[model samples]
Target: MPAGDSWLFEMKYDGYRAQAAIAGDQVRLYSRGGHDWTRQFGFVAPALATITKGTALIDGEICAIDQHGRSNFSLLKTSLDGRSPIVFFAFDLLEQNGEDVARLPQAERKARLEALLTDLPADSPVIYSQHVAGNGQQVFDAMKAGGFEGVIAKAPAARYYGGDRSTAWLKIKAVQRQEFVVIGWRPPEYGVDNVRGLFLATYEDGQLVFRGAVGTGFTDKMRREVHEVLQLILADGPLDVKGMPRAEARACRWVEPRLLAEVEYTEVTPDGLIRHPSFKGLREDKPARDVHLEVQDA
Candidate 1:
């Protein structure tokens, strides 16, 4: 098929991005960053071995679905405690049989992928990632209502542009929400400045962006707990701002943004600033840098 400008869009799954390579009877799973996670997902190796033809390269997410039909990352992480079955939602077929399909138009590749999955067991871990024909906005809205992370839009005929954040593939995230390590605090001016607001920071593109501080949405009890946590990490020095911290009328006291807290915000401004963010709660699982902004779409 001749490649065109038409693109095929798919749901931006909210799990780990993985590439499954099936050659003969052997299967190897590689993370997007090129790490081998096959041993971590040992339960999926056999499922992948079912591919009977030549080498096949599949790109998708390794997610665990709960009884409620929702993707649960926390469950996956806990269950695996380093060993669990992982369902691979295959979204794209980069190679099949003995042919390399990465250079083919997306529509053709998708058709081939659909045909390949049609005869698989109904409840197989390997399933297709369905796409909307032309209603991108509808899919986007549906994802939001369902609490999904986001949607990716791809040119129907665009070839695979590996490791490139090309405009050809666009991502539209539902909302920017993550748990960040509260390395420091900025006190509100008025009454008891036990800990007015929190300093938020996450790593992105290898650079740290202080996503501004959040003071709203804190209960008195939550404030006390946060104050205790910040007290231990307290250091006597001005907060480090590779870039100047944007301050509002709210008087502030700076601390090391070292503790982790869950936060939800509307979006990231063009200059990498977060807008209208509010504190959610404390998160103990994730590290500081791992809390960075993620582009949900392509």
Candidate 2:
């Protein structure tokens, strides 16, 4: 369905997807994969506790904001390990008073989530993720102009899908960058020299899928550094990612899918290859198995 009066749009922050659950004096924070990262993002639980009294499950993103107020992806680890500025932007209320309200409509759930954080102190680590209902095109235009990542649109009447990706919740990006598992790398060639290109893949519907290669955007120094790491992780084959191009597969020197990289692209071709993809950097913090592609409808 097209975005309009029936949809809710919010800024899609670039950060760690997390869920914070608070019950009385106890609080816990979990990654999207269920890892307990409370020690890492230590400020989330306490701040959530100060405002939310009853047992509640809140869905949000833990992010570091820059001088321009945009979420900074590269600083996420710094926020966890150093004294960087960070905040947990809560956008949905999944449970309350020991009751699961995940099946509630999006608007109602968000309304309750806002009420739960109405009194959160400015210094608190938890901040409410604000949104505008409808007018999504306007938001997208603004995000593109401001160099913001994208806007997410959620069906106002849709139910939350726990630990699952759903089409009801969609993201429209101003920039196209995705994390890929580095299964292999081509040795430095080009008249210049370093690592040449990277063979990439991602998880889709819980299955590993080949996403083809990215050869551009690497500086000589970056190639040298990553080539060094690739030497240590060499393997006999790429993970069982299906649909790899025959020629690419024949040429690949496989490595373990233990590395992740961020890639900027123009679009995904119909056959699933990245169009004009360029390397952004290594995503040392993200796990290979957790990297997934956003499936676009035909």
Q: Please tell me which predicted candidate would have the highest lDDT against the true structure.
A: 2
Clashes (candidate 1) = 17
| Candidate 2 per-residue lDDT over residues 62-135, each given as its tens digit | 88887788888766765665557889999999999977789899999999989889998877878898988888
lDDT of 2: 0.80
- TM-score of every model versus the real structure: 0.66, 0.83
Clashing pairs in 2: none
Write model 1 residue lDDT over 160-274, tens digit each, in one string: 7664356666777677766665657766466664678877777666555666778887888778877877777776765555454445312345555556776778887887667
State the C-alpha lDDT per candidate.
0.69, 0.80
Which predicted model would earn the best TM-score?
2
Tell me the deviation in Å of residue 42 in model 2. Answer: 1.0
